[model samples]
Target chain A: MKELEDRIRRDGTIKPGNVLKVDAFLNHQCDVALFDAMGAHWAQLFAGRQIDKILTIEASGIGIACVAARHFGNVPVVFAKKTQSINLDGDQYVSSIYSFTKQREYPVIVAKRFLQAGEHVLLIDDFLAKGNALHGLIDICKHAGVIVEGIGIAIEKGFQEGGSKLRKEGYDVKSLAIVEKMDADTGNIEFATTD
Target chain B: MKELEDRIRRDGTIKPGNVLKVDAFLNHQCDVALFDAMGAHWAQLFAGRQIDKILTIEASGIGIACVAARHFGNVPVVFAKKTQSINLDGDQYVSSIYSFTKQREYPVIVAKRFLQAGEHVLLIDDFLAKGNALHGLIDICKHAGVIVEGIGIAIEKGFQEGGSKLRKEGYDVKSLAIVEKMDADTGNIEFATTD
Candidate 1:
């Protein structure tokens, strides 16, 4: 967690609209070595849980989920597709994610076959801000009668209510790095940890 | 490679239109342990090559690329975005991929900064059918002036011309499992030897 926070401080860029650009290492350009370390950390945190599958939303979450799946005993990873594709059959368990940045709700779907009843799924993602995307994944899992083991997040915006809200609900949510605040003028990223 | 071929034959569904759906293990429902083995195989094949990055297209390719990155020293993994998003910027190296399955040509973009000129890149993907997606990736690398060291594919339709064409052009393309012919009616899959 400390390493991730430090890496964010060193390389993360703060843009207007409260966006933190971590494309260099986290999402766009991935550091697989760091991800392996991240997977190890998550594996430790959620040890002893029955994680049958790794669930993540599309685009950014796919990369991290795939890497983390390696540590989770090579479980099957089912990523919810963010957009409609010919590959995605219309008969899907669909949920809407309200993207504040994009200013709309997009439908995320999963094939009925990929997710089965009574399966234990561990949700993974890059960032948890408004909790819309994570909530959407949870919805799909619920629709399939699956149990959510826990959530593994690369970064969480602590100032936002999503992380705390999920924690209050007694979900096993683990975030590698939590960003407390960021200054656009001074370009300083204040991390959440006391250290 | 033998194990992969066997798994495909057992789980892959041969549908109409020559579509071999191995979503159970290869793409949609990923077997991470198998991907680990495949990644190790790719690492061995491209050993000694100075690979600075692992480049792949999104959706299906992200799963394999993430696992393979671990074997390659956890090098950076960058995937080309298939759709326009707020996270995507204007300055991008873009290419058009004609998806015969989808019957459309969509723009695939990579952040201009993630890919740099003269970097050794290893292109990876889940399936190599027509080689159109691979060519799109290659085009992106060409636009950025990056050196493509080699390519690693999880499965190749040997009956198709994709693999042979790349090999003839002097590219070191290694497909973990190459299917000779897939019979939809009988559900038979023949694999090519590693040699």
Candidate 2:
């Protein structure tokens, strides 16, 4: 977690709309070594827990979820696809979610056979802003009869209410690096206390 | 590679239109243990080579690339984004690619800083059919002045022209499992000889 925070501070560039660009290491260009370490951290945090699978949304979350699964006893990882491809079978468990970043609503889906009833799912993602994507995944889990064990996020915009709202509802949400505050003018990133 | 061949034969489904769906493990619902084995396999095939980074495309390729990177000495893995997002900044090397799967001409972008000149890059992907995505990533490397050491594919539709073309051109292409033919009636899959 400290390595992630340090990497974010060293390479994360602040843009106009509260955007912390970690494309250098977190998103576009990934540090697999760091990913393994983070996976170890998650394994430690979720030790002695019954996690049957790791579920995440497509694109950015896939890489993190894959590496993290190595630590979580090599559990299977199911990523909800953002778009329904022509090759994708017609039958699926679907949920609609709004992307606050893109300012649009998209349907997220997974093959019905993947997520089974009573399966304990650990939801993972790269960033949590308004919590729309996380909730969408949770909705799909609900439809599939899967239990949402907990949520694991790499970076959370703590100023936003997404993290707090989920915690208030008694959901176990774990975040590695949280940006408490950011200033574009000064290029400052304030991290939240781990506890 | 035999293990991968067995997985495809056992779990892979052949659809009507020459679609080989291995979403159960390779892409959608990822098996981390198998991914580790795959990473090790790739490492053995590309042994004694200096690989600085692993490049791949979004969605399916991320998981494979992340796991494969562990075997490549935990090299940094970079995935080109298929969609535009607010998080991706202005400074980027972009390439336009046409996806037959979705029937669209969209742009894939990588942070300009991710791929550096003179770095040895190994392109890894889930499927190599028409080789459009692989070519696009290779073009990005050309634009960025990076050296493409080789290309690693999990599965290659040998009936397609993608593999043959790359092989003709003398590119170091290694497909873990190459499917020569598939019969939906008999539920049979034939893997081509890599030797």
Candidate 3:
């Protein structure tokens, strides 16, 4: 976790409007080794919990979740699709979320057969800001009747309400790096102290 | 390679209109263990190549490429984005491609900073059907002036012209499972024999 926090400090850029650009290493261009380490940290944090599958949203979370799946004993990683495709047929658990990054609302879809009742699933994502995406994934999990074992986040905006809201809702949220404050003009960033 | 072929034969579904769905393990719901095996196989096939990075598209290819990057010494995996986002700022290498599955023309975008001139890249994808997606990635690679060391494909529809055409273009293509023929009615799929 310290490694991740350090990496973010060194490589991450703080933009105006609280936009933290980590595309250099986290999302667009992935550091799989870092992802593996994050996975290991989550495995330690969520030890003793049953994680049958890893549920994440598409485009960004797929890489991190898949790499982290190795730490979770290679559990199946089901990425919820943002767009509907012809390939996505049959019964599906659908939930809609609004993405500020993309500036649009899109449906998160997972095939029904992929999620079975009573399965314990670990939710993983790159960032937790407004928690709209997490809420959508949680909604799908609810519809599928799957148990939410835990939530693993690579980076969480501590100033935002997403992480706190989820924690208050009885969800075990483990974020490796939480940005407490960031400055756009001075390019300075601060992280929340976690034990 | 045999492990991948076997898994495909077992879990892959043949739908009408020549659709071979391996979503059960490959794309939608990913089997990371199987993906690790496929990564190892590609490592063997593309051995001795100077692979500086693994380039792929978003959604499906990100997981496979990121997991496979470990076999390539944990190289950075850069996935091209299909849609424009506020997070995706600055200069980028953009190319348009038509997706048969999504039934729309989308842009494949890679940030210019992620790719450097003369860097050797290995293109990885989940499927190589008509090669539209690969072509888009290759175009972006050309714009970025990166050397494509090889192309690693999880599955290739040999009946389609994509794989053959890419091979004709003098690319070192290694497809784990090449479906030479498939029957939708009978749900039988056959792979092309390889060494």
The alpha-carbon deviation from the true structure for residue A24 of candidate 3, after best TM-score superposition, in angstroms, is: 0.7
Off by over 4 Å in 1: A89-91, A101-104
Higher-lDDT candidate among 1 and 2?
2
lDDT of 3 by residue, B78-143 (tens): 999999998999998999999999999999999999999999999999999999999999999988
Tens-digit lDDT string for candidate 2 (B1-195): 888999998899988778888989888899888988888988888898889999999979999999889898889999999888887766788898888777898888888878889999999999999998988898899999999888999999999999889878778999999999998777888999873
Model 3 interface root-mean-square deviation: 0.5
| Number of the predicted model whose lDDT against the real structure is largest | 3
In candidate 2, the residue pairs with backbone N, CA or C atoms under 3 Å apart (3 or more residues apart, or in different chains) clash, namely: none
Model 2 residue B139 distance off true place after TM-score fit, in angstroms? 1.3
Model 2 superposed RMSD (Cα): 1.2
- What stretches of model 2 exceed 4 Å from their correct place? none
Q: State which docking tier applies to candidate 2.
A: high
Best candidate, DockQ-wise?
3
When summed lDDT is taken over every stretch of 10 residues in candidate 1 chain A, the lowest stretch is A82-91
What's the TM-score of candidate 3 when only chain A is evaluated?
0.99
